[model samples]
Target: MPIYVQMARCCWIICFLVFSSLFRAYEASPGDSDQLYRACLSQCQKTSCVGARCFSCCNSASDGSPLDASWYNIKHLYFWWNHWDCQSNCRYHCMLYRENERAELGLEPVKYHGKWLSRRQYGFQEPISVAISALNLVMHFHGWRSFSNLIYYSLPLKPDKTPFYDYAGLFNIYGLLAMNAWFWSAAFHFREMDLTEKLEFSSFVALLGYSIILAIIRSFSLRTDAARVMVAAPIVAFATTHILFLCNYKMDYEWNTKVCIGMGIAQVASWSIWCGATEHPCRWKLRMVVVGGIFGVVVKMLDFPPYQGLVNSEVVLNASNIPLTYMWWNFIKDDAEFRTVNLLKKVR
Candidate 1:
């Protein structure tokens, strides 16, 4: 891993948490506060119409919420199941109408509530990001599947039937954590709700913190369980404390950024060093990943608005990860085989 992995993960978490913590959340475009947009919203709430387009949810409430609506109306609104209600429908329609007018007037598109305007597909609020996150999840599943097959099905097992590779279990857990993190990431991008946001933030931080501990274990070759636990205890403590603070107490964006930056830099540096020292066949892939990760970090730092009001910087960041992820998993597979073969030869 290089800077991009940590930077991408942290930036995604920080961008949302920071913006939400710092300002009033407007679910629509930055023009949400504009007099015209406000007036349009008010009219939509009262009349259930945005221009000639009318929404049934709006008819259920003056404020465009179904909180006071009858059961049938509530059921009707939730039937779509994409989490769309009167307020969101009104905001989406109004924002598009406003942006279309702005385009005609030659005005640039602006962010809404700290979010760049994004095109939604199949009810995904950020379709590109959601899709890419899902792809990343698939990559993990692929890697985990292949690795497990190689260990359990292809290779000879020990007396107790455990895989020959010493680190097999560790990497298996790693793959699971990676998959879990990506799943939450896709969900968060689909809709930035309180629960999804917390899970997305917590899952990645946990994964990263665990990765750092794993890096220490693998790089140092801490084979003994006690040695590994000694290396992990502090990291686990910090991660648990931070997650609790973020979820239970308050989300301290600045503090979290500092912690992630420090830990991420160390993790990348250690892996780069180990990759260089290791004579494994897949070391080349690890080296390539290191270089690419650094370049990606640089890429993520350059901030630009969504391209064509659809693909944003975050989506691009997620896309950049797909290849890195593939190569990294490939390296893990090779490493596992290499280690297993070495163990068998020792027995011989």
Candidate 2:
């Protein structure tokens, strides 16, 4: 490899580490950490208002019966989608009240509990991300379908009536897992909570680890079953153990960040080196994916604030991956096409 390629690879790895830091450890945000905000929250929880802008849910009973005797309040759409109970309602409205006061003094909106203040952010928080996640899921499905059709339909099959691609089933599983991860991601963005958070993390981690394994298997040409298993067993084991550590032991964001960064860098390095060395027709396509991933990370690192109070850093990040998804599936189709033809030539 050229010196420049080596340097670029190193820098890419560093950027990936920074990417993991986007999942920062939970901390109080500027608005939430303010003295006045806390005071307002306390008062609101007690009295259910800061002047006239009151939320009836704030004074609801412990069992969720409305204290204000407003029948429609409990049936409100925000409560249905956001699951905002009395206390959370109090915290949210108080934050908004404080932000309004600050805005009156010509101050900009600040984050409360690690989120930018927005009226639409209440129900189905991170709506843009949720939509993008769903789109990613759809793209994954489409990619998987295209790849499968290219192999099983577009190309000739072996005597047993299967695709000539050695890892056809493996890539199939990869596609399914990719779709599953995005499904959970959409769910998590739609309604974030402990359960959804775990589902999202576990699904994503599993896909990440599986992707690394696929990279290893493909890069090293582990064609035989034993050879592939020899390379994949340890990685699968480690990924499973890490998931257990998070789900059963502790959901430590910092530790998870380290694990993800390490695995992500490994995955990126594997693909980068292979793409550099391979004479394969689709090599440049894979390179584009890697470079595009780096560019996406750069965009994410430029996090200023949500654009027009709608799109956030994460929204852009997910959107960037959408094109890459199409590219990847396209690459997979081309790979299948080339592999079946090339290998058949060797046999002849």
Candidate 3:
């Protein structure tokens, strides 16, 4: 076999190992299993009690009847969902506590929207996830400003002189796509609506695939308009096709996961190898970025079943990933500026 083929095979093996190790370590530690229940009970003790139990305020049956008898009556009564902004999570947990107590007395577990309340988040809405998404959107918008300034003022005005200028449009598009993706991410986590979920997933996949294309184009120094378009067109088509397949036809979780993982590996690997091979000043920074990116992926994958705490998966993963990418982007831009300056000096 050719050495290049062997090297390519080795890179794939390493990526597979990285993902497998992350998958294996994706267990959430439910430390002190009764801590949340105790906390809920403590809060309940502070409120005015109807008999021995706290008043049904946030997520309980309104008829003041026993859950065992009126299970159907309040099964769908999610006060937290109705008044998400106003309802406290304490009240939600209190409702869960009540359900647990009732179940011990032979009452069946209650279902809301065809899902058992146990699987539902502590509250009807995921405030943490929403907040993280908002923060990520803000970061992306701020990066947009920085990126705009870098592209417009930092790059040479004469496109005939440098290859980096041809990429301005692609970078700008990437920023817009990132912001759009985060917007839908926040919306989906806020409401978990079907449409929002599809939008978020599609937008993010588009951003990921586009990032890979951008990395390849810039890394190889493909500055000509024709070369840039040739490389980007196929990637854009694939991303758009995948999004349409997901949103219009079937939202296949398994396929989505596979494609996303592939793109993520390609993205990190491309940049890492390019930075290593190039004479860029911030080459070493890419090493840190790739490591952080992998850890971020692990953090994202750890989000799983039994999401029953103040900490949310969406929040954690976004917080972990966004800053790393943000810094990585700045490093990339700096490297481009470095190259652009040298190119201008040579022309002068």
Winning candidate number (TM-score): 2
| True-vs-predicted CA distance for residue 137, candidate 3, Å | 0.9
Each candidate: what lDDT?
A: 0.75, 0.77, 0.64
Number of the candidate with higher lDDT, 2 or 3: 2
The segments of candidate 3 whose C-alpha lies over 4 angstroms from its true place after superposition are 1-124, 154-156, 159-166, 301-307, 310-314
- Which 10 residues in a row give candidate 1 its minimum summed lDDT? 18-27
- Assess candidate 2 and give its lDDT: 0.77
Worst 10-residue lDDT window, candidate 3? 24-33
Q: Quick one: RMSD of model 2?
A: 4.7
Output the number of the lDDT-best candidate: 2
Residue pairs with colliding backbones in model 3 are none
Task: Provide the TM-score for each candidate, comma-separated.
Answer: 0.73, 0.78, 0.64
- lDDT of candidate 1 at residue 52, scale 0 to 100: 81
Error of 2 at 326 (Å): 0.7
Segments in model 1 whose C-alpha atoms lie over 4 Å from true places = 1-79, 82-115, 251-263
